[model samples]
Target: MDKSWIDWADWCSKPYRAKLEDFLNFAYVNRDPSSRIYCPCRKCENRKFFEKVIVRQHLHGNGFWKKYKIWDKHGESRDGADSLHRDEMFMGSDDYMEEDMVKVLNGWTDKSFKDLLDICNESMPEGVNLPNSYYQAQKLTEDLGFTYNTVDACPNSCMLFRNEDINLDQCLICKASRWKEDGCSLVSDLGPGKRKAAKQARYFPLKPRLQRLFMSSKIATLMRWHAEKRTDDGVFRHPADSLAWKDFDKKHPSFSGDIRNVRLGLASDGFNPFRTMNIVHSTWPVILVPYNLPPMMLMKQPFIYLSVLIDGPKGPGDKIDVYLQPLIEELKELWDEGIETFDASSNQMFQMHAALLWTINDFPAYANLSGWNTKGEYACPSCNSETASIWLPNGKKFSYGSSRRFLPYDHKYRKDPRSFNGLREYRRSPTTLSGVDLLTQLQSNGILTEYRREDLQTRQMMGLEKPEKDPLKKRKHNWKKKSIFFELPYWKDNLIRHNLDVMHIEKNVCDNVLETILGVAGKSKDNISSRRDLELMGIREQYHVKRRESGSEYFDPADFEMNNDGKDKFLIALSETRMPDGSASHIARRVRLKDRSISGLKSHDNHILLQQLIPLSIRSSLPKKVVEGLIDLGKFFKVLCSKLNCAADLEEARSRIVVTLCDLEKIFPPSFFDVMEHLPIHLVQEALIAGAVQFRWMYPIERCGE
Candidate 1:
């Protein structure tokens, strides 16, 4: 952060600075406790000595890198010109330059650059070593063609001040100045103006970055793994092969025509870099991931490319659409005109077309992007049909409230005596088949409709008319109009346009399970009602019960409460125990629930809950059927997370999730549904199509907000 470090150092010695006697006294005063100063001469080199005589002798002589001729031969040196020539000689040649660069690249750091020239002066090289400065190394890297594509943007979350608007002085939307008016000359002068300048986000075009990926032959070939190397076998190896994908492909034949065209998945979320959870200010980064890679390499961070940073003191929220304008414009171009790209593997330049296959995000982000109400009962994205919900005793209502009725249409829970009598018999009618049809149905609602059907008014005309009082209520009435996704010409199909982030979903489900079990109010601990239910399930004695002063029983569930096995006993047990599929298993790592932090339970903890702990450890305590159902769910998640060659197991896993969701009454307590309705729509749609087992899971964006 300091500018002084960037200044170049002078190599020549000062003329007549001090006579030999004065220099000797000055050097003696600066000597260490051992009465010796370090010698910089070629022979006496940088070594601490007990004798002051040795240090003085070295200073009078020439060092390998530091020539003494500059000082001693000052009068005969053509006013330091001949001494300067000799100084160059002391510096090494091109051969040693290569070795220096290798060291620079491998051991480069902030301090390394600052001390580079100093290190060269200290080095006693046998051969000529070039005196390479920090700037020279930077110039070398630039000559090697290292560059980044950067575009300026308005400090406010307005349009990019790029292209035709590059010369504009102010933003069109917010009227914010394109550049800071008060240009500070010194670091001391930098205050509010510099802070404002810092807020101006930079846009890095993803097109060039994607092209660069193809420059590396090893990575270039891996980019085509999904299309060429992966075995299809009619399974869901990638989203391209999913049922939703195939449906979209069927609807738009021309778009899916080129198998070689790149497919991209977009993802974005707001977060506070400061790690202060309650802070309202957050930075949002829009990221694009190439889905052409295999499952193992897909989610890796290095492969994830940043398209833009939405600089902020506050999150963009619903207004995230404004920041996405540039991305959307680029995407439209990529989809339509394509780009001329060089492929290293094929060793040729080709026209590469890229499409945003889908977006991956948590529920809140998905809702912000898709304009779907994830909080409502009709939250199911696949089927816009009405879902069953019930008013609970807690003065709140929940969908799939009754566990007995939580199953698939044909599931036996519909007849189970414990299920809501006659309630399970209610059947819902089907809704529209496509997003277009769904939009039509929503538009027919009188409150949202700008004009009557008989009036024969267009939507544009409706917008011109003054709305009735209570505009906020009207806006609330029609969430569809607020959604930008419906307007995108490319992403017409709502079902497959956005994807559920698998990471968030698994983390959310795990949090719910752990919260209820651990009895932590805000974390993955079990709620009071869930604990009471567990008591009713006939395992109350597993915990410790204390007699209070009032002679009433006080339950302290710590005895049975789940804790992290500090020694990883659970992991050992899981590894040794035979799984239901008769496979020997090794979990990635041991998850410790007890090691709680401000973020509540971590991903690894949730992983353990779903994969090993729930399936293997809690079998005896819970009902046999419930244990089996949980194990089934866990296995499905495990398969989904795995990197399999074929989609056979993936499809089967998806189907099992739907079935497991249907049997939730047997698997989990009723309180879980209170949180289920708010899950992202992608999970709901995927479940409806693949068999209703998977959609019941929740997304974990709230964890980030916390």
Candidate 2:
């Protein structure tokens, strides 16, 4: 079709009208005249659909979108050489061709891009051609094979309108209308009226995404990096070097036989999409990282596949399993019945299987994923029901202690009482539960034997029904419900099913130490209440609050507390310190000299401060014992976070951390030892099993979201 009429200045001309009629006939073709087609008006921009008459009226009134020359969405296609040749015409004559095009395309409308192209074509030699507009240029590189399915969900998260419930207008369980209640016109009027869904989840299918990885020759080779190119030395560098990975291979030889088989790590967390504290909304996104790639490229944004996006004004919480239904179903299929993937590097089709090795999340999210409560008494997932916790009445929180039990049986710290909670530690470390032990406990508790056989068997797999509870009965266990991942055949057998985020643990520990030592008003853990807790525990007497004759109480300064001068000097030292560019954000700006406190530190900032700055800055001002403990803590993190670590170093660090925690117990009040401070003890064991912390940590996942 002749598109010269698009360049005509006058829309009223007879020649333009004749060309417009010809274009309309071409667009309509054999279709019904009443059928709606995408409007090419400036206002609509092919987003709105209109009847043929309304579309013609829109084109006449607003003019055809000048850049839509190819008309791909409107049933027109460039044939033969024309289709393949247009992409080359738009290629920029520069080394940074893609970058240059992106710069030109930024904020440009279709007509603006077309006008620029017209200027370029007119100035260039007669034989040269260019892509008519931005849309045409974009089509050349866009992967139309990748798409997301929008599944309507109940506003209350009861069920998704899918499969058996596909045509249902309302939720089967909740009986709530599937369509939005707001009075708005249906989106597409030509078809049976379809209202906007009340709530919807976007599921990017895992099968095609995984297949696309093998379609590229470079990526296809990289997908087998773990098995093919990785060094098999005992040193820990990648997930493949981990004991868990090896154990999985030993158990399932058939799955590991193909180096092309994918191993994936799942990570999820809720973030405020609006990026404001005032907005009371949470949106959860589930991301998957393929561990089959080498360590260098594994966590990069390009390889991070966002499989499911759960839209939320409120987080799904335990009901997140409802949203994970599609992804889990695809994973099940991938594991049982492999997908036929064509490998560009090998030039052959192969059956590809994938298994979710583990999930990575923060403490609160750990509860949602693993169905283990990470709060109250049984807060430690590693320790399970044997978590050593004591209620601090004055501090109004649970203070976790008993690090001495983890120490060697004959270790000197086990005999010393004053250094810890003023009692001898005779108990052994809490028993580590195996997969069989966990299943046995669940069965004995009636979770698997009764609930699984009855409720789970009767209802839909992904249905959101709260487990029945007696109103007056006291809860005896921390197990919320069996995790959705356990439905997978091999979930229970995996050594590590869920991971503890080292990033959050480091940040919390840093905050506690920094705030308490500096005595940052309300933020300090060593407040009046903490001193009273020490008095209640009948330990650390010198640090207890003393009553004055005037009926006011004054607490004695602990060894960790810094005087005003010390605080000033410490703050000033941190403020004056400079780091290499890109090594860290500007730490100087976060230090408040007048306030004598550090503020507005992000997770990575805290990581740098804890690992590098605090040990250096506090040595001059703090007591020798306090400084030594802080330094040991810092060194523990520095070694644990190393890119390459040996088993001997981790084993030694494990014993060293026990002594560090014992020393800290002597210095800081009992209230200082929250779950975060004690969690470091278990981190080494996890690292020993999972290899480097980098592969399983939340830093890459959190940064990718940003």
Question: Could you say which candidate leads in TM-score?
Answer: 2
Q: After superposing candidate 1, which stretches have Cα over 4 Å from the reference?
A: 1-195, 217-227, 243-258, 275-281, 294-296, 376-387, 391-411, 415-418, 429-433, 438-488, 493-495, 521-600, 623-626, 645-659, 666-669, 675-706
CA shift of 237, model 2, Å: 0.5
lDDT against true structure, model 1: 0.52
- Write down the worst ten-residue block by lDDT for model 1: 1-10
| Clash number by candidate, in order | 20, 0
Model 1 per-residue lDDT tens digits across residues 48-116: 432456544554444222433323211113232223233233234443456556664477674565476
TM-score for each prediction?
0.61, 0.80
Off by over 4 Å in 2: 1-143, 183-194, 448-476
Candidate-wise lDDT, in order: 0.52, 0.82
Residues 147-238, model 2: lDDT tens digits: 67889888877678888888887766557777776446433232446567878899988988898899778999998888878998899999
lDDT value, residue 352 of candidate 2: 97
User: Residue 515 error for model 2, in Å?
Assistant: 0.6
Q: What is the Å distance of residue 155 in model 2 from its true position? A: 1.4
